[model samples]
Each structure stands twice: as structure tokens, then as C-alpha cells.
Target chain A: MTTVEKIKPLVLIVDDNSTNIDLLVNTLKKDYRLGVAKNGQKALDYTEKHLPDLILLDIMMPGMNGYEVCGRLKTATRTKDIPVIFITAMTETAHKTRAFEAGALDYITKPFHTAEVKARVKTHLSLKKAREHEIYIASKIQKTLLLGQPPRDINGIQIAQLTIPSQKVDGDFYDFFKINNQCFDLVVGDVMGKGIPAALLGAAIKSHFLRVLNELIRLTDKKEFPDPEKIISSVHSSMIDQLEDIETFVTLCYARFDMAKYLLSFVDCGHMRTIHFHADSNRCSLLRGVNMPLGFPEQEPFKQTLVSFQPGDLFVFYSDGLTEAKNQDGVLYGEKRLVDFVQKNAIMESKELINIIRKDVVAFSQSDIFDDDLTCVLVGIEKKSTSQALSDKAKLEIKNDLTELARVRDFVRNFCEGIPGFPLDNNRINLIELAVTEVTANIIKHAYGEHTGERIQINALLLDDKIVLQFYDWGKAFDPKSVPLPVFDGSQSGGFGLHIISHTVDEVVYSRDKKGRNCASLEIKL
Target chain B: MKLSTEKIGEVTVVTVLTEVLDASNAEEFKTATAPILKESNKVVFEISQIKFMDSSGCGTLLSFLRQLKSSNGNLKLCRVQEPVRILFELVRIDRIIEIFDTKEEAIKSFKMGI
Candidate 1:
């Protein structure tokens, strides 16, 4: 149950004559909250400050007539829905018609029978309250859908997004989805206009995109992610009929970030060109868009552009609201300012950069209100730490399967070879490889119970004339000391694995963490 | 590791066709010859192609010898390369399996019925 209790509906009585106001006040004061506006301008100002459920008007005001006041109220979007009832002395049919034309909901003669006035006011107030409640619920649902939880980071890419709606429901939205463990997709879109219609279209387009993506994932090979161009085209095709029916178009940009290759492939559908800030060069470049906005032509060929990213590189995707935002002086905050801002702050974190850009735009516009919905998505590629770049350390993850034993050996050998001071003679490297293979085999056979998807993470470090290898697994706990040493009598085929692992390394230890993860550390003094 | 076999009078002669028999290729060599050892009691391995052998390589040979002997058969090594011969001496593998200088000598030992 809602905590706040319902108070009586407020009604504004606008009349030039005090006697008429008193008459209305005495009739309704006990039942409603009341406001008195002596002239047309005062009534407008009062309505602007506080929205009243109903307005009682007199047609014979001095400066601005009741018809003019009603006309102004009907024209403004915010107050147009508020019901206005004209109470006047004129009884002619022409006068009543004029009252209706001026946006009055009901009319009454000047005598103003108490019963008639009360009944009309009560009916109009109830109708207004019902409509407001309906809109409030609709806006709440739209808000939750528009701002659903989006991933902040996927793999090594950092994502930050900002959306400011011009109305209760924004037509602009951005989304983030992980295609796989190493690949993620970032999508930003803008519908043609604002408010309820545009918002519904935005939701429909988002749902369509998700449906098409799921279909593509199901149909394609497991190793292959959905193609960005094909996804856009499919979503566009499915939504074209509805979009045409609504007679609107949407601009969208979809980019897929591949963490392994450090590549970004994207399709821009007549959207604002995305900005790329190159960390190495400290320069910003706008990516080219090659296709028309969706829901336009039947078969617009969607071409995607591929860009390679380096560590510390930043990508900015935004709607036109930022570029078209104007100051009090009517100067547009153009693309140049955005480029300059990004280039200057390219070294900052992705979230910080997004926040600063949002603040800058607000300061430039000199107002909190935006005429158009504005949205921005910032993605940053992580930079390698200095120690990681200098040290001879490598981390590898492999499936818990025996066939991957060879791969584990290859990874360890490669890491040992990277040490400049120690070539790590073939014999020592061979022994290390054997120990790694044995450990991995044991994990696959014992710890994971021959499971395939479970992962074993091995971190190899060559530090201070020693080689240390640490392994972690979220499988069942394993006690190295509990495994009896195998007799070296040359006939034991199965138990030799653990014995060889223990003898090959200088020191071996195993323990389980509080979270039930198994950690094994092995060291070799070379 | 690659293998080729020739049969003469119920004795199987298998040759390893690689220069090095170290850790990387040792397991594969064992896998390739396990079926042959399981089938034949009298087997001869021509290892002249192997110039180097590591401890894993020696262990694999010992395992093969043990498996063969348990099945009432015997294994002989012929055309022993010098590096492999040194490895065999280091591991004292020469005392367990018969070693010969040529494939004919190994085949003669298997056929001598001693």
C-alpha cells in the first residue's frame, strides 16, 4: 500500500468579481483546496506554478477574456489536459459554442446553482485524477525498461553509458551485451522523435534486436559470434512494417568488441559518426557512416567498418542531442568541442570521462532541460601495467581435458623462453613441462572428475633465478600430502603421475581457500 | 614419432623414424608401439634413427619391456645410436633388454631360441 494519504483535489477559481468568487468559495471551500486568480495572467501564473485538478472560469474578465485564458491553457502541452469549466451569465447558444471552442470542458449560467456546480466540478476532478494515474503508471514502466541494468565491463573493455530523456519516457537508449567470454556488443540508438510514441518504438526496436541476435546465435556455429551487419539488417527487416505504420525512422550504431584481437567492428545506420580517441597518437577521429537510417528503404545495404584498437584507446558513441545542444546565446555545442574534450581527457578512466563530458554539456547549455534526448556510451581498452610488461609472467586458462595437456606444456615453455637472462636449458624446461602436464592431467582426472568446461588457470613467473608456477581451480579440493608417493619400482602405471609431479619440482604445496577454490603452488630452483 | 614394422618368422621388427626421442615425442612413441607390444611376444626395436633420448624416453622403453616380459615375451634394441646408448648405460637399461649393433643381430638373438 502507498504510504501517502490522498488529499482533496485542488480547484482554481479565476474571476474578476469578488462576489462571484465568494459564491463559488462558499459552495466548494469545505470539499476542496482552493486558489483565487483575479485576472487572466495571474491565473496562468498560478497554473504554471501548481497544477490544479480543475479550473472554474468567468468569461467577462477585463483584460484577457475567459476564452483567451482557456485558449492559452489548451495550447500548452503541460496544462492542456487539465479540465476547465466556464461559469458565466451569458445563456445564448453562440456563447456556449465559443466557450467549448476555447477548450472549456463544461459551461454554466451565471446564477450558478449550487447543485449543478458541485456535480460538474466533482465529475471533472475524478476524470482528471484517473487520467493522471494512468500516465504515471505508464511513465514508471517506461523508465524501468529504458534504464535496465547494463554491463559495466566485459573482458578487458570498460563501458560507461549516460542517458538523459527529454520527457518522462526517453526515446534514446543504449545497451550492452556479451556475445561470448571475450567478445561484447555495445549498441546506441535514437528514435526520430520524443515522448510516448517514440518510447514505444524504441522498446520495440530493442526487443527486435534481441530476438534477431538470439536467432543468429542459435543458427550459427558456437565459435562464431553474430555478424554486426547481419544483425542490424535482420532487426530492420523485422521492424520495417511497424516503423512504416508509425511513419518514423531510427538511427543506430552497433559495435562488437573482440578482446582477443583488440578489434572493433561496427555498422552505423545513418547515425552520428562515432568518435575514436587514439591513445598512442592523442588524436580523435570520427568514424564514417555508410548506410541510411533503418526503416527507410527496403534493402539498404548495411556495410560495417573495422577498426583496430590499442591499449588505452577510447571510443565515444552518442546521439545528436549533444552536438545540437544550444546555449542561452543560441550557440550550438558542435562536434569540435566534443572532439577537443575527448582528446584532452583521453587518458582518464572511461567512467570519469563520461561524467566530465556530461557536466561539460550541461554547463555549456546553461540549463538542466534538454530539448532532445541525449545519450553517450564510452568504451575504454585497458592498458598493460608496467610490471606486467616487463616481467616474464604468463597466465593461461585451459579446459579440464587431457587433450589440452599439450597446450599447457606449450604455454609453460613459451613463458620460460621469454626470460632474457635465462634461456632455461632444454632439460630444465622439459622437466617443467612434464610437471605441468602431470598436474593438469591430475586436475582433469581427479579434481574436476573429467569435466570439460571447468577451467584450470596457470600463472607462470620467472623471478629471481627461480621459476614459480601457481594454479587455481574451482573444482573439488585436492590434498597433495594425502596422495601416497609411488614406489620407483618401474611397474606402477597410474600412481607415477603425482610422484613425478612432486619429484620434478623443488617444492609443491596445495591448499583450499575459504571459497572452496583449490590452489597449488610449485617452484623450481633453476 | 613415426614407426615402421617388418615381420620375419613370428618376430616383429619395429623402427622409430625420428632423430630425437625426448619428452615431447616419448608419450607418442609409447602410444604408437603399445598395440605392437601387446600382440607380439618377440619384438625388436631399431632405434638408429634416434640420436638423443631423455629420461622419459628411457622410462617408456622400460615400461614396454616390463609389459612384454609379463606377457612371456622379450624385447631387443638394435642399431643403437651413441647418444641413446649413453642414455641406456646411464639408466642401466642395457642389463634388462638385449642390445645389438644391427637389426640382423637383434633378429638372430630373437631366433636363436635361447
Candidate 2:
């Protein structure tokens, strides 16, 4: 077999003097792929097209000095991570400090020694390689830990979540557990440090969640859900030593949603404050408790607080990457802005709400790249209405006046009650009523321009375990896409109508009937 | 909409006496109640009779909240009906304003300066 050739790491050399260039090149050429640039500008131009594994730059050069070149390289995303070593004839300590301040990884003094050059270059190159390997491993571990999928087909809760693993330091995780038909649990965790170590710890914490939970299940009654505090306490005890060794901690928020009891009990451990959207008051509040992040030995025991929620309530659990995101002005996106955004868009479906929130955060920061892991989870409380039986169909008619809204609700209530064995609860019926009222209001306000003497038709397609409501109006045809996602301009206008309708119903489809009437159909799965 | 008012401590507990607080009477209720509660900084809206409410009605409450806030005063609610209460929650207006389960609690909150 023919001998295989090793691919040497590429190195770029920049020097104004050809003699010095020749000296350095002869020393490095034997072990590296060498690229030569006579001036700083030439070196920058070379780096623009080709990325070298290492850069040896001369500080004293005319036309774009090496300090300027190294600064530019460190500022650029593509070249920022490339290791840059400076070469200079000056023996002053100030020059060396300036070189470092300009982001030079290391510097070589004047009058080059071939042995010293070889040793420094070899050591720096190996250090760069080791760092790259660590990042690669860290990212791989983060990806593996993020393999969980949010549970599906929950009766009364809508969950939307996002996770973006970072290149440098990343350790963000979220998981959902189905405790029973009437209850569920959600936990979000983030390791405080960056890079490979933090990522590994995050993975470890995620692995421990199941072990701690299962042990509680085994030791206690199987019929009951594990307590949030007990599970977190056990996880902390097991992971504290490892965390202390690493000098880092994990922020965790564990919440249990009990649908039957209408309670959300949670234990917050040094995580970002969880946002609570109260459906009854049209308000948002930050939820936090007195507990240190995991690994704090002096911390009080984690305590769970219980808060009641009605249908249409919402919650947002996020990592620091979201709230701590910085704009060009260095202003943090901040918790207040997030609360406002959530309050404005509270009527939206959870998936749409979270995706828009992510987009908003990126837009506010003016960049998509994050130095830390970005993660967020949204939860919306909904009505789990059960009907005793199904009906084939139903129909109703109403005037353009807003007074007709009450009549519309009555019609829906009667329709659901008329069905045998229909699961009609206060929460479920409330949602259908709200959706119907919202659409009718939109028709009167936007389509009819709030004029009187207008009439509309309502038809209900009561299928198996679902209801589809259709509304027909002779008013102007409307483009649903024209409406922007909800933002509070302090007005009742904008997309609140569409948001509420979409949030309440499983599906909303708008079409023009054969009779040229505007038809909007909304479906709710039982 | 019909209106009834009572004074418990420094708080004026106003109750809407009608079942419907919709577009038909939202503007009227806002206009009539704003003057009577103008002299007091602490106001409690005990609206249990409002079994049905629309967005305009909710807007009326918010406008009053802003008005009270402008003067360094405050407003609260008590005994809101379920349907109307859920309506406020969906729009998140309850966060801007405080709601109490009882009128006495509302008055007590004003006394406690909460």
C-alpha cells in the first residue's frame, strides 16, 4: 500500500521584511501549510478568502498595522476564534500589553530564535486544537440531552417550547412528565457556567431527573404524583458535589399542573422567574420563591407554592439567554419587556406565541447568534370540556349588534347541553363562547364597519369528539394575514380578535361561500 | 346598566346592578361612574351582577384604572362573575388592576395599603 500523507494545520505569516519572513517561514514550513502576506492588509485579505488554523502577525508594519489587523480579526465572527500570535522587534512591555489588549493570543520578541519560535508555535497550536475539541464534544453532549419531545394530547394544557445549543457554552434543558390524566409536570434547568463542563453538567442533571422521580415513585405510593420539592431536593443532594467541584450551579423550575384542582404548584430554584398569566384578570405576574440555585449548601429547603388557574391562563418559563439578551446599545431585553410582550400576545396559541417571542428577542438584539444557550417553554391553560354524547349539527342566526353576543353564548351552551353525554364544563363552554363572541365582534367592527341592520348565520358541525363552528356574514371579505401578531399599543385594536379565536379553537379556516358570503370556520377538539 | 354604591372605610364599593355590561351600556357606565368616584382615590367595583361582559366593557374598567393611576390613586374589583372574570383574565387586564374575592377584602386591602 502507498504511504498516506498527513494534512498539516495551515498557518499564515505576515511580515514587512522579507528576511524576517524567510527566517520564520523556514522554521515553520516543515510542520505546517504556510501562507505568506507582506503587509497587514494583505493578511486580512487572505484571511477573508481562506481560514488558517494559526496566524503569526508582525506588529511594526506600515499601512494597517498588525494591532489593527488582529483587532479586526477578533471582532469578526468567522475569524474571531482563530488563534493569533504577534511578532515584533520592540522589546517594551507596553508594546506587549498593547498586543494582548488588541487580542493577540501570544507574542514573539525581536531577533527570532528558531528553537523558541518552534516551541511557542507548537504549544499554542496544540492549545487551540484542544479547545476546538472540547467545544465539539460539548455541543455533541448538548444535542444528545435535547432529544426529548414534549408530550402530546394533554387534555387542558397547550405546550410550546424551543432550544438552541450554543457553540461556546451551552446547558439548557426542558422536560414534561404526564403524572395522570388530570395532572402533569414540567421542569426547566440551565447550568450556570459555559462550554464543555457546563454542558456535561446539564446532561447529568437531566439524567438525574428520572432517577430521582422514579425513586420517589417507588418509595412512596404509586398512586400519587411525586412532590416537586422532594424530587429537586434529591437531585440537588446527588449533584451538589460535582457542581461545587466545577464552581457552578443549576437553575431549575419544576411545576405541576393539576387540572382537576385548578392549581399550579411549583418549586423555583434560582431559575429565571416564571411568568404567570392570569386568565381571570387579564394580567401577568412573575413567580419566584426563596430558594437558592442547586449547589448552595446554606440555602433553605426548596418550597413549593400553589397558585390557582382558570381556563385560558398561561405561563412562560425561560433561560437567562432570553431575558439577558443584549441589544446593540447593550440594553438587556429585560424581564419587563418580556412580560409586556406576553401580556399583549396572551390570546395567541402557545406555539405561535413562543415562536413570535423568540423572533422578537432576536429582532430586539439585532442578531441571531447567542453566546449562551437560548431556551423557552410556554404553557397555556385551556378548557377540557367533555360532552356526554354527540349531535349531528346545529344552527343559529344573529343581528349585527354586540347585544347578540350574549345570545350567541346562550346558543352554544344550549347546543352543548342538548347533546346527550356532552362533557360540558364551565371552562370548556367558556372557551367556545369567547371564540364565537370574538369572531362576531370582528365581523361587526371590521367587516361591517360597525354599521347596523346586518345579519349573520352560524352553523355547528358536531363531529366525533370535536365541534366545528362556521359563521357566514355578507359584510366585506377580510384577509386574516393582514393582522399582525398582537402588540399592546394601548388600544383594543390589532390582532387580539384573531388571537383569541385561534387560542380558543383547534383550527380556524376562512373561505368565501358559493353565495359570496364571508365564511369563517372554527373547530374545537373535545 | 344600573349602578349602586356603598362606602366601606375609605373605599367606595360600586356595584353594577345589571346582568349585561356590553357595548350597549359600557360607555354609559363609564360616564356615570367616573364622576361619582372622582372625589375618592380608593374605589372598589363589586360587579357580581355582570354575568356577561364584552371587550368594550373591559376597556371601560381599564380606562378607570388609568384615570386613578394618573392621580396617584388606585382601583380594585371584587365579586366578579365567572364569565366576566374569565374575560378580564384572557385580555390580561386583571394584572393592571387588582381583584378581590369579597368587598370586605377589597376594603381591607385599601386599609392595609396593599
Second chain TM-score, each model: 0.95, 0.93
* Candidate 1 Cα errors over 4 Å, as ranges: A1-5, A27-31, A39-131, A192-200, A280-283, A320-347, A357-374, A385-526, B1-25, B28-34, B37-114
Candidates in order, TM-scores: namely 0.57, 0.56
Model 2 chain A is weakest, by summed lDDT over 10 consecutive residues, at A383-392
Query: On residues A413-515, what C-alpha lDDT tens digit does candidate 1 reach at each position?
Result: 7776554433366566767776787677677778999566899999988776677899889898887677776544556433555666666688888889999
| Clashes by residue pair, model 1 | none
User: Residue by residue across A311-367, what tens digits does model 2's lDDT show?
Assistant: 788999999988988776668899999999999999998999998998998899877
Interface RMSD of each: 5.3, 3.1
Candidate 2 residue runs with Cα over 4 Å from true position:
A1-10, A14-51, A62-65, A68-79, A113-123, A278-283, A327-331, A344-347, A364-367, A382-526, B1-114
lDDT of 2: 0.81
Best by lDDT: 2
The best candidate in terms of DockQ = 2
Q: What's the fnat for candidate 2, on a 0 to 1 scale?
A: 0.12
